[model samples]
Target chain A: MEHTQEEIRKHVKIYISVFAALAALTVITVAVSYLDLPLAGAIALALIIATVKASLVAAFFMHLISEKQIIFWILLLTFAFFLVLLFIPAMTS
Target chain B: MSDMIRYISKPHPVTGVTNAKLGIWCFLASEVMLFGALFSAYILLRTGATEWPVGADLLNVPLATVNTLILIASSVTIVMSWASLAMKDLSRFRIYMGLTILLACAFLVVKGFEYGAKFEHHHFPNSSTFYAIYYTLTGLHGLHIVGGIVVNLYLLFPGSAMWQTEPERFLGRIECAGLYWHFVDLVWIFLFPVLYLL
Candidate 1:
């Protein structure tokens, strides 16, 4: 399970690049928010950008990309329940 | 027996991951539900309201932007700390972890100022649906930050002694903490736009 020196260096490089990407995306999110798009359009754009940023953090930073299948199953279940939670409002309405 | 401890520390034969990692993921699964419920409530409240103030008008975007950078910086440092330990560089690990804690503090201080400004303007949770959701969402997220700081501080200080005796387990613990910290930052990533920008 030990990482070679080269692997460690590679990871550090990836971390730095991910940091830069997250920061750049944040700036883009803020800039786009200022546009006078329709409300739904703005919300969709914002959430989409946020989702991309979240994916980066989860995949690279949290190492979820190479995680075990059990963990993915756990998250899939959580996502299912989360969808159910969101749909309750729509159903009621 | 030592085998039992080893079983917990090493990846399971079937799952190919350590017990600590499995436990943390399970805990995070529950956390997703907790926050998901609150977020669902938020969507319901916002959609149901007749009039809702634009979030940008009420919130301090510049301040939150700074806070977002701070959290992002901390997230990097936390992962770097774990990386340093993995590379057997304790000195660098200490430096990185210390920076992570300091950045976490900076985020809270800036957030406190934001809250203070709201109160000074007589904006409370009951001020409007916007303020109510703002305070609740940010407040809950702030509490998570505090929890992360507490765990990270323990590992950086008193709990660091474990590194000498059980480096692998110590690294695993830090990785778990980093996972939680990254999740906190992820929550804020969404929160920044949802609460501040949108």
Candidate 2:
């Protein structure tokens, strides 16, 4: 799906906003790390922030939010297989 | 001709994207699995170890933090470059793409110093399980940055001639490169916390 110049101009604004959010999130994550929480808590908080950051990148920069159905299915299948891979190690341990 | 690829410059009517776009997503899917497996290995090994080293204490958090921000900036710049092309501004595209490449190189320079410091203090990959996983993950991520730099450089200079012949197709290439670059940044987002914070 091709965006018009107007839509792209609008996207440039969103891109800048996402960049600011990502930069702030990066700093927040680092500060949270220095709090020296317990390992499990640190892991949980850090992962949550990282997931949000990843989502922003995927949705905006990668255009997954407006992406086509075929790409969605492809990613879903990949995620399913990826979960199975992670589960193997978890189940074994 | 039967040999001609129909969707090089246009989206397939059904699939809704050019072949290059779909192909890159498939490639990224495989990459996700590759990194996912390594992350799983990291989880298992750390869980099994009687004592896993605290990440910040053992690794360099401040430097990793800077690198993380640098990569995030590059991700934004890359998307901006793509946007510039979409709007038919080749010179603006060049500037944004050039910034993306420069930020990528800056990330590597920071990584180099981090690694050099590690080696100076005798923190080789074989130093322990933590160091091993640390090197493996970050090293692979670094290589991805290098790959992004190479692709962005091509798009910035020699490969840019395609814009004259087929601007839309060339823009598609930029979109693909931007996607790949963002994925690399996404990987680092997780890696920083996993290797440096946790």
Candidate 3:
């Protein structure tokens, strides 16, 4: 799809802001890792921060926020299967 | 025949996206499962083991942090390249795309040094379960970065002529590449904290 110059400029600004946010979050993740929290708590917190960062990249950089429904469905299915994959360990344990 | 051409050249009626776009998303979906399975295996091995080494104690945290930044920067540059093209500025597109490739190379180089250090210290993949997982995860990720660089390089070089002939399709191709690159960066975002910090 053709983008107007204004839209392109807006996207560039968003990209810059997202980059800055990601960098800040990276620092936070590193600092928090050194806090000596319980292992599970640390892993959960780290994954939570990483998820937020991943969401920013996916939503803004990948343009998934405005993506078509078919792609969303595809992702939804993927997420379902991915959860199943993760749960395999729990099932056996 | 016309349907095939339309499938490639125009957006689908149902999806409002091109076939290539849809195909890439599906491919990426499978990739998510692939990596997910590996990560699940990592969890199983870690929990089941009698003793597990802390990640930070074994891996080069400082170098990995730098590589993370480089990958993140590359993600921005790739998106910026697409934005430049969206503005119909081919020159700026080239500059941004060039920077993206350079940053990709920089990440791989740092990764190479990290691997070299591991080998020098006799920390091969078979050294320990942690090392095995470390090498497997990062090596696969490095290969993905290389794959992205190869595509970006083609677009920045010989494949760029499409911009003059079919600017819209060319832009779409770059957008797809940017999506893949961003996904690569996203994987590393998780990998960094999981493998290096946690």
- Chain B vs. true chain B: TM-score for each candidate? 0.96, 0.97, 0.97
Off by over 4 Å in 1: B1-6
**Local accuracy of candidate 2 as per-residue lDDT tens digits, B1-198:** 723877977889989888889999999999999999999999899889999887888778888889998999999889988888888899999999999999999999999999999999999999999999999998998898888899899999999999999898899999999999999999999999988888
Per-residue lDDT, model 2, residue A73, is 98
Candidate 1, residues B1-198, lDDT tens digits: the string is 666565456788988889889889889888888888888888899889887778899889989988998999899999999999999999899999999999999999999999998899999999888888888889999999999989999999999999999888899999999999999999899889988887
Per-residue lDDT over B1-198 for candidate 3, one digit per residue giving the tens place of the 0 to 100 score: 545556565798878889889888888898898899999999898888899988999888989899989999999999999999988899999999999999999999999999999899999999999999998999899999999999999999999999989888899899889989998998999899999998
Report how large a share of the reference interface contacts model 1 reproduces: 0.77
Worst 10 residues of 3 chain B by lDDT: B1-10
DockQ of prediction 1 = 0.83
Q: For each candidate, what's the DockQ?
A: 0.83, 0.87, 0.87
Q: TM-scores across all candidates? A: 0.97, 0.97, 0.98
Off by over 4 Å in 2: B1-3
TM-score of chain A of 2: 0.95
> Cα deviation of A73 in candidate 2 (Å)?
0.4
Kindly provide the TM-score of model 1 when superposed on the true structure, using C-alpha atoms: 0.97
